[model samples]
Target: MDTSASPLSQEDFEEIARAAARTNESVRLEFLDGKIREKAVPDGYHGRIIEWLTKVCLQARPELWLYGDQGLHVEAYRRGNARPDGCLARSGAFEGAGEWASTEDVEMVVEVTSRDRDTNQRDRVDKSAAYAAAAIPVYLLVDRGNQSVKVHSEPEGGRYAKVNEVAFGKSVSLPEPVGFELDTAPLLGWVG
Candidate 1:
């Protein structure tokens, strides 16, 4: 898919959508929409980690929003939407009415990868460029398959300077945008 096409005017795309829907009954349409759709899955270790992280974030700083499994569009980039496993952002960054976020309005984005063996690249590669392009300040990735928590900061021109990684028992400090340290102990312990 081309990820660089300039956005078409709303009218132009709506016409196309209407025509396509007229012929196809199986197509579910979503465009510039802010609704989220997630597959149901058993609550596993990854989910537990996210839950713990969310609690820690709230306890440490209750004013920020803690979001999970929701789409965010940061820039006008024509890339596939990104859904962070868990995230923290201040309130009122975007249209404050729905389950999705305008990527441009987010400050921190986190992704927790499960045991989907073949789809891990979606976290490491695709989201890396997409988040950087959106200029999101911090990106925290929890890779259960690898037993690591990778942190990316200082995004410059569609990339982040690879900085820190916390394994099962370690913790890392995020100083910019927010002041909180995440201890990986709870996360690692949740694994088993």
Candidate 2:
């Protein structure tokens, strides 16, 4: 392969992602504009956090449904397809949808920061931009690096207006739709 020679075309990038996904069920691919990124295979602690968060949301509101690693279609950017760690949407949000749900159908997007610093920042920075650009309403970031949770909301001009944060042991209140306090205690022991 010619190193640093040419940029990958959209079709080529999508194909590469497709091929990787075919063989690895754990692979979650994201296409932002013309850039492609893959999510790291989560550890047991990460899985537990995802499950716990989902359970909390669902248990509080039986009418809503939370999906793990659900595809989000961001029409604000070209070739934008994000697979969020957890996607909480109103019931029947994906009833007639394909593999992805449009931003309008989403209530909140959850991301559990990985062990890698770069990966964690990507979730906090890159993914934050993508979701805000789509006006997806809410972006919840669970930071394992600092054992804290950040909730970003009020999207405008490719950014979020409000950012609320709290330590792992504290409870963070989620806005409407998922109106409830998220207990972060269970996530404390898994912090990096």
Candidate 3:
């Protein structure tokens, strides 16, 4: 795929996304690496996993909040737009921002894989690159397909320098900026 030449410009994509949102509330669109893709409307288990993470984050860091399905401007020069499953930042970080908020205040971004064909490319690969390029401190991916959690950190030159993976039952430490240890044991129940 030639990422350099996208079919729709950034502005065009944003307008289409807004229209899609207004017309069909369930349809979510994302633009990454010069391609437009539909983000799957999460299922029951997916919602539960996000809810579980929200509780843990609130308990560990009362000062921060995890905003669900928050739209964000990502990738180099904010060229890509993504709606992360959870975006962790100081409370009210995006108070006045519109549908697509800058990644400046985002400490960490999380993606819980949906049961769809695009899961592997969208969540595991493209999103990681986009968040890292936008310089988000952490990118936590709960990959249901692999039954594992992948923590990508240390962004440098548009990519994460470190990526650590652990199975569903294991505990993983989400690094600094979003300092906390995640107990992923409950994730076993959330996957099909």
Candidate 4:
């Protein structure tokens, strides 16, 4: 079905997204790189991973909160909308901000891979690029598919200039704005 004359247009996508949000509570919709896609409803393992990460982030930086399923306006010029698994920012950063908040105050965005065919393109590639283009300080990808954690930082020219990947049992440090080291050993249990 032709959703719009130009499906890539943000205006058209937002209209459709609003309608979808009203009609469907079972799935989340995202607009990235000119395509609208459904984000998988996270499973139990996904919830555990996010819970663990939230605890870790809070313990390390009490001033910031890891908000789950926070909608954000991503990509250059805020042309795309994404509901990341977690959004870390100073507490109340999004207070009073309606759905699809700007990325300005977001210190980091996290995506824990879902057990679905779209995980690779949706999480590892598309979301990473969208977050970088929005100039978000850090993008943390808990990649269950590869049994690894990928940290994307130092955005430049609509892409991350630095990427660090470590196996689930290893420790990885999130950069400056999101200064913290994650002991990914706990992650191993959350992934199949």
Please provide, for model 3 over 110-181, each residue's C-alpha lDDT reduced to its tens digit, 9 standing for 90 to 100.
Answer: 999988998988898899889999999999999999999999999988899999999999999999988889
Candidate 2, 54-156: lDDT as tens digits = 7898889878887887777775865477888888887788876766667787889999988765575478888898898998888999988878899998889
Q: In candidate 1, which residue ranges exceed 4 Å CA deviation? A: 1-42, 92-99
What is each predicted model's overall lDDT from 0 to 1? 0.64, 0.80, 0.90, 0.89
User: 45, model 3: CA deviation in Å?
Assistant: 0.4
* Tens-digit per-residue lDDT, 114-181, candidate 4: 98898889898889889999999999999998999999999988899999999999999999899888
Top-down lDDT ranking: 3, 4, 2, 1
**Model 1 clashing residue pairs (backbone):** 73-103, 74-103, 74-104
RMSD of 4: 1.8
- Indicate the residue-level lDDT of 137 in model 2: 85
- Cα RMSD for candidates in order: 5.8, 2.7, 1.8, 1.8
The TM-score values for the models, in the order shown, are 0.73, 0.88, 0.95, 0.94
**Which wins on lDDT, candidate 1 or candidate 2?**
2
lDDT of 3: 0.90
Error of 3 at 155 (Å): 0.5
lDDT of 4: 0.89
